[model samples]
Target: MSDSLFRLDAAQLAELIRSREVSPVEVVQAHLDRIGGVDPQVNAIVTVAPDALNAAKAAEAAVMAGEPLGPLHGVPFTAKDSIDTAGVPTQRGSPIFRGRTPARDATSVARMKAAGGILLAKTNLPEFSYWIESDNLLSGRSNNPWDLARTPGGSSGGEAAAIAAGMSPLGLGTDLAISVRGPAAQTGITSLKPTHGRVPMTGIWPRAPRRFWHVGPMARSVRDVALAFSLLAGPDGQDAFATIAGRAEVGAGPQSDRPLRVGWMVGPGFGPVDPEVVATVRAAAEALATFGVQVEPVGIPALERDFALDVFNRLHVMEMKPAFREATRGHEGEMYRMAKTMLSLPDTSMADFIDAEQAAERLRDGYADYFSRFDALITQVLPIPAHHHGADKFAIDGQEVDATYLQGATVPLNVTGLPGLSMRFGTSRSGMPINVQLVGAWHAEATILHVASLLESVSPVQGLFPNI
Candidate 1:
């Protein structure tokens, strides 16, 4: 029964809690037990909230008293360690901020709690949440739950791993390049990187150059992501960029019976993709077609120019380097290797940043034009499945590729400030999860999520659990 409790999705857990079939205390304890049993092997959760059980007790009391409950009432959720959690430590995966605790919850965390979600723990990330792998001086390395020796994908790797391993039902993770979606793909879960600024960034660490940064949910199901997104969206008064409208009805909308046009791509555009990864995406496209959706292989010529990653890298360095230099001015030795490598490099010149911004505009315009025709674009989240841990270089289908190419498919949506989602569509020959990305125009989360929800109904990887 405890195992069954940990296996339920957040929405299912909430329903059970609301119906008195399962107490909030029982739900929270089941997850805590799962974490205790499995997290040692994965190192996904860095810090467990000391008051989680107490919060669950209170939630149970609310149920017993016949109080009105929120959407996620009694559902346990985790957040990336870089997200502020009020009294809980948010170490940002660095020894530099080891014991740091924010005085206030991040806007997303507050919203989740307000919706009756219990904060369970802080998951791991790369130092300063900068790298594609979740490892740092503060909390060691997080192993992939599926393979144990491979990466789960990063900066949000631990968030994905925890959810995939059933240690938590749902959680929040920030994306700049591929943090949320890539990790979800690798771990066989689901995630949404809402259009930039759709959710508030207040209280999240490394919060500069807000245009490309976004925070959204990572969960076992697409509906769970939509539910969390509905609650997390909208202006928080503190984050200037979060002044957009919310899409709370996205998940609840009826599935369309009308034929939809879908575009699919495997790139000469993004980078070299593994044969298995391409096949997985193609299979998912075929599945959509089977549902009366018109699917076609399409290409975006701009993606061939590869401006997406360049735009992200240029702006990211321009915004982060100065602050990083100051933060580690004399404590360089205390920082992680990746942080040292990044901060020691030359900074992006104003002229270079200006050029990148211009290119970003072109990238956005290109996607806007393309989405004007297609309902949504589908592609690989990463070129390959989860790779071996601590690898310095990657070989895809027997050919070596730059490790940074992992950001290929995901960075483009960030450049456009568009919504993109990832879900496990198939499994690799080695049995690791493979995911596909679904991208839509700005503020088109509803459209993309609706398509994702449809795909979820037929996903080959649905109901599959990691061996961890």
Candidate 2:
């Protein structure tokens, strides 16, 4: 396995390497070379490890010695910068914590290593992982893999761009507010924001997104995502948020998917979605019908005001205040700067936060009720494809909408603690990738992955890259 090997998914490469058909060294080299080539243009990855080769060699020796294998067995992947990697310069995409190193790997990182996955790099993200753009003082900005002028979508933008460009076969991304799914949509990749709390966020920043954040896999295909996810998910004692949820098992035998009831929500739960986005999603729904899925257009009134508006934003803003203070100490940086902009508003009253939580409970109950009726929910991640770099808000067919409310259909799921998968469906008229999200009931990742796996097979999203 040299740097020439960019096309194999995490599972494919791991199996070959486990059988000695390929070496970890080759896989590491392939990724490094790929990054060296296209990363300069896409800016997807911020840090490159010169010692990744050494780690691969060590893993290769263990394999040669006939040692017991871990789940990943020497696969390579990247992590969102917000997650701590022992000894890595995890700056959290800001200058305040620039060059900061944790003495121990985060619980998730340690688990991945325990499963035999190697950290190839730390991906770029927005300052504090709070914004749509993956730009900051430390790692700079990550551009879309398809077009340099557009965003890759944050705060997991770098991971999505890298995975899309085949720089890494798989990677770990944290999604709170569409950080993972939005990037998947923008860059034409596959990602999962697992059932909230399914994966631990031991070393990630803002800690506020904990209840909202999900650490999941970003890859070239549904199978790759499934493989990566199986390795990273589980309960680690360190994460209070990691509840006792059942982890989805990868297919070890002849497992067949069952016919599913899919409720497709197009508009009104949010705003006017782009005709192109609607058309692309509708086409995929038709394709899934051939796979024995009942894809019916439906409306969801739960997410309407049940999730609440300014109250929902305030809930997040209030939770972030303490973390922001801890990071900045006393001065104004991007993290603090953004924090002040939100916290400066005395208008965000304590009553609002309490009311939002009450509303969130109602939204949760509504989702739970809805799931009892349908196997999964199909919707858009972004109202449209990734916007131009300088565009302020997303507009659908000349109608303007807030970036947070529209582009990210992810917030409500977080509010309800459900699972969501971001699957690339097609390219937009501008030639950028478009993605649709499939949301499942709490702890129903197997069902969500099944639908994603089925749709990935039939839709135009099937160009799972060649050896990049």
Candidate 3:
């Protein structure tokens, strides 16, 4: 019975705990036991919170005492090391800040705990949370559970890997480019990259350039994502961007009766895409259409120019480099290789910055125009499935491509501050997970989550688990 406990979703555990069917301690212990059994092979978790079991006991007492329970009461969740946790070490996968523990939890983490969720552990990530793979000088690399030789994607790879492998039922991961969504794609799970600033960034590392950064929920199901999102959203009085604009209902909404017009694409648009990935995305669209969604093939002309990636590169290097360089000043030698490389790049000139900003405006307008016509746009989360470990480049249908192309499909949504949910659709011939992105207009997370819930009902990867 304890062995099967890890297979239950966050909602299931919460329901059991609420009805006194399963004690909180049992649920938390099952995950800890699972982590003990699998983490040596996966390397997804960096630090197991020492107080987790004590908290679970407290939660159990609350249940027995008949105290009111929060939505996720007694459930356990993990967080990418980039996000701050009050007592747990948040090394951010860099040796420079090893043993560093924040004074208070990040808004998202604190909020989750307030809702009765226990902090199970801290997961791995790229050094300084700056790259697309979770490997660092501090905790080592995190391997995909599906095939130990492949990557789980990043900078939230560890979060996705932990959830997919059943070490944790839900988690919080930060997204800049494809950090959250891409990893969710690489691993066979689901993640929500809420509209930029929908969640607070108060205690996260390298807090400057708060524009593109986002803190979001990742889990085995879209319903869990929505449940976490509802708790994390709204102004925290710290993040100016998180100001309320009126919230969108998640599972319950009037849009269910009306057919949702969704635009689907697999391209010549976001650079060269793997053939299998393209086929899987089309199949996912068809599955949604079966549920009465108005799914159609549509192209965003600006994406064909690959302007999204270009814009993000220009802005990122300009905005992030200085702060990163300052943070690693004397500790440069201790940082990850990618962090050093990013800092050594040439500075962006005013002319290039202006040009890139203009291009960004165009990309935002393009998505705005598209959303005006369709309820959402469905596309590939990554052009390819999880590539082998240490691969600097991968081939798509016999053509070689740079590793950075991993973020091609996801950067546009970041630049536009649009919400996107990356959920499993199918599996590759090699058996790696395949995911598609459901993008909605700014602050349309509920709409996208609603659509995703419908997609989840018939997901090809639904009920599947990694053999690990």
Candidate 3 Cα errors over 4 Å, as ranges: 245-250, 253-258
Per-residue lDDT tens digits for candidate 3, residues 283-358, read: 9889889878899999998776546888888888889988888889998678778888988899899999999888
Output the better candidate (1/2) by TM-score.
1
On TM-score, the candidate that comes out on top is 3
Candidate 1's residue-wise lDDT over 254-284, tens digit each?
A: 3456667889998766878999889988998
Which runs of model 1 end up more than 4 angstroms from their true locations? 248-258
Q: Taking the candidates one at a time, how many backbone clashes does each contain?
A: 0, 7, 0
Per-model TM against the reference = 0.97, 0.94, 0.98
Cα error of candidate 1 at position 366, Å: 0.5
State in Å the error of residue 241, model 3. Answer: 1.2
TM-score of 1: 0.97
Worst 10 residues of 2 by lDDT: 249-258
Error of 1 at 277 (Å): 0.8
Clashing pairs for predicted structure model 3, backbone only: none
Candidate 2 on 1-468: residue-level lDDT in tens?
A: 454468777888888888998888888888888888888888878777556888899999999999998867778888888888887778787888778887778877787788888889989888888778888777677888778888888889998889888888888888776788889888888898888778888877767846777788898888877766776677788788786655564332113365678888766665678888888878878888997777798776777766434445867777776677677775474553345655564545877778888888888877888877788888888888888785676667788776665544677777777888988887788788888898888878888888888787777757644222
Error of 3 at 22 (Å): 0.5
TM-score of 3: 0.98
